[model samples]
Target: MASTSSGGTVELSGFFADLVRCETRLYNALNDRLRERHGIVTSQFEALRYLRDHPGSRVADLAAEFAIGIGATSKTIDRLEKQGWAARQPNPADRRSSLLALTDNGTQLVGAAEKTFTAEVAELIGGTLDSSSATAAAQALSKLRSVLERNQIGTPTG
Candidate 1:
């Protein structure tokens, strides 16, 4: 690991590269496992889990939380609806937007998938890093995420 020094600050190019690569690899692994076991990909599992936790959320809310576009989120929701895992209800508060909720099938599937997700995370991440190192890494990443979110950095503008 090499760090380049600019003035008095250290450039984190390697750190950024590692972060992106690690995220991609981890996501792929999780997606593969979830698809194999639950017949749903990681994104679907995440959306279902979110709907389970926050019933009556709108599609826009899911898009915002996932940092994706509305079109993409709507597509995912469409697939879920077709699979009978989720449904959209008319929003009395807003005629234009509908609220989302997980169906009974979705609830059962997500509950089972949650166990697999937890075990995989434990095997992959927990097995790789020690307790203290994992804690420190999570804390650092959380702080960085907070700063970026607070500043709205890298958010899509239209």
Candidate 2:
């Protein structure tokens, strides 16, 4: 097999490579912890977290926020509901759509999950990123996302 630099890794642009590696590392790390503690996937936690915060957010809106397909988002919500962590009500604004909110049980469970998730992240990053650094990173990533969306480079896939 022919090889050209970068240890024969498949050719990927710098930005794409960084995104792939970062996502892989972060997802793997979080998945292990979330599974071990709550038996939930990161996506499930994200769905419940959003519902907990948004109170009466519509399923479509949550799907948009997560940048995931409607069916996939619905599946996550279904799992959450089955777990008694989330509840859905008529949107009222749109009969075709349903609003999502965390059940009391969900709110408490997710709260605990979040605390554990945060502690794990803190330990992983150690003091490498303080509050300021974390804030800056968030801002930069947000800006990058805006640019990508604006130019149609990449739309979030939840």
Task: Using TM-score, give the best candidate's number.
Answer: 1
Q: Give the clashing pairs for model 2.
A: 66-158, 67-157, 67-158
- For residues 17-79, write the lDDT of model 1, one tens digit per residue: 899999999999999999999999999999999999999999998987887888999999999
The Cα RMSD of model 2 versus the native structure comes to 5.7
lDDT of 2 at 105: 89
Model 2 per-residue lDDT at 139: 94
lDDT of each: 0.92, 0.80
Model 1 scores a TM of 0.92
Poorest lDDT segment (10 consecutive residues) of candidate 2: 1-10
List the candidates' TM-scores in order.
0.92, 0.80
Deviating ranges (above 4 Å) for candidate 1: 1-11
